[model samples]
Target: MHSLARRALHTCNVPRDLTQVTFCDSAGEHPDRVGLDGNAAEAVWRSVEALYRTGVHPGIQLSLRYRGEQVLHRSIGHARGNGPHDPASLPRIPMTTDTPICFFSASKAVTALLMHMLSEQGLVNLMDPVSYYCPEFARNGKRTITVHQILSHRGGIPAIPRETPIDVLWDRDEIWRLLCAAKPVEVDGAKVAYHAITGGFVLQRVLEKVTGDTIESYLDRYLRRPMGMKWFTYGIAP
Candidate 1:
């Protein structure tokens, strides 16, 4: 093992109870069935530690696997600020291996995977126009915009207007209506620009339309539940 992995292995605070490790198979009961490079695994942990030490992030929870078998799992640091939510704060609630962290834009990739699953089930087609699943999406000359374009960042509707109320984001109906009625900034599929938040909203509606279920429900039934995840969901319920 590399020095990095050795240090990580020696210092890692793996919880005593196997059940406390999130994302571990059988709660980390089985040994490695396939050989994994201890050095490489250690390097991954060292990198996370270095980032935390450098103030890049306050804490990290990482899990690594090889050939479908977990090789290394570690979690370290605080969940929040010790001082008010200010820069001067030190550490607060200690983060555990199982602490639930928000994915933010990382959730986009998850949504994309969900879309692929729906496509594989033959309930949705990437090549089809967005309007095929949600007819309101056809407004403002968007009838020609394909799901493929949206996923690829070529749909041309990148942002809702600046005049849109900030609070409207939490109101799904208002956000959906704004996106459906909004015009493309350029010709659809003519260019590539990150859609940021708009793509997710449109995709959510499309997925719900095809699956007859919300994105959260579809993920729970097909993804999270099968994987044995206890708390993963699209959003926390109010």
Candidate 2:
């Protein structure tokens, strides 16, 4: 395990979660396709073992969709713990198709999608001032900020002050208070900077007020359940 990981670390930057590790540096051949006529099972297990030798691995599923049909579906690596070793001290914990894994910040793209859909459907005007929808949000100097600015991450309070207590972030009232009092470090809508984490939460509240729906229900009814994408959330799932 140590030797395999040494090679992987030297070759690639596949960051591992010490408490929750997954596959490291999953790679493929240059041929673009792996034949599965016979010995397919052996090939799949070989790929799994190759990953285990490196370090802790996660289940990685690769599928090819063509003409509305899935031509190839491959599962590589185990879920959590080291499974079993081939000729070593450990074994490989093989992964199955039904095993669902946490898809982290990829979840935010879904939130962005919800905003896009609302814009396309004419339900939410992108230019509308957040203050227009949520009058209470006009406090401080934020009265003029637009939904476009917020979603595009130009809304004033881009940089939440560093001294904010990390524990209070989940406290809705405290979080809003910090954001409400924050001053914009950059001019709104000049150039663009990724507001990273703060923009999403602010947009969430504004979204809820305008649609008369929580971000989850608004996203799920119009985005997830309809679109058949279930691995989505704005915050922790209820």
What TM-scores do the predictions have?
A: 0.78, 0.64
Compose the digit string of candidate 1's lDDT tens values, residues 29-126: 22345755667776876677665544335567766656766666666666665222334344356666667889888898999999999899998999
Each candidate's root-mean-square deviation in Å?
A: 7.2, 8.2
Model 1 CA deviation exceeding 4 Å by range: 1-31, 35-40, 82-91
lDDT of each: 0.75, 0.60
Give the local distance difference test score of model 2.
0.60
Task: Show model 2 residue runs off by greater than 4 Å.
Answer: 1-58, 62-74, 82-92, 95-97, 235-238
Residue 40 lDDT in model 1? 72
Provide the clashing-pair count of each candidate structure.
Answer: 1, 12
> What lDDT is obtained when candidate 1 is compared to the true structure?
0.75
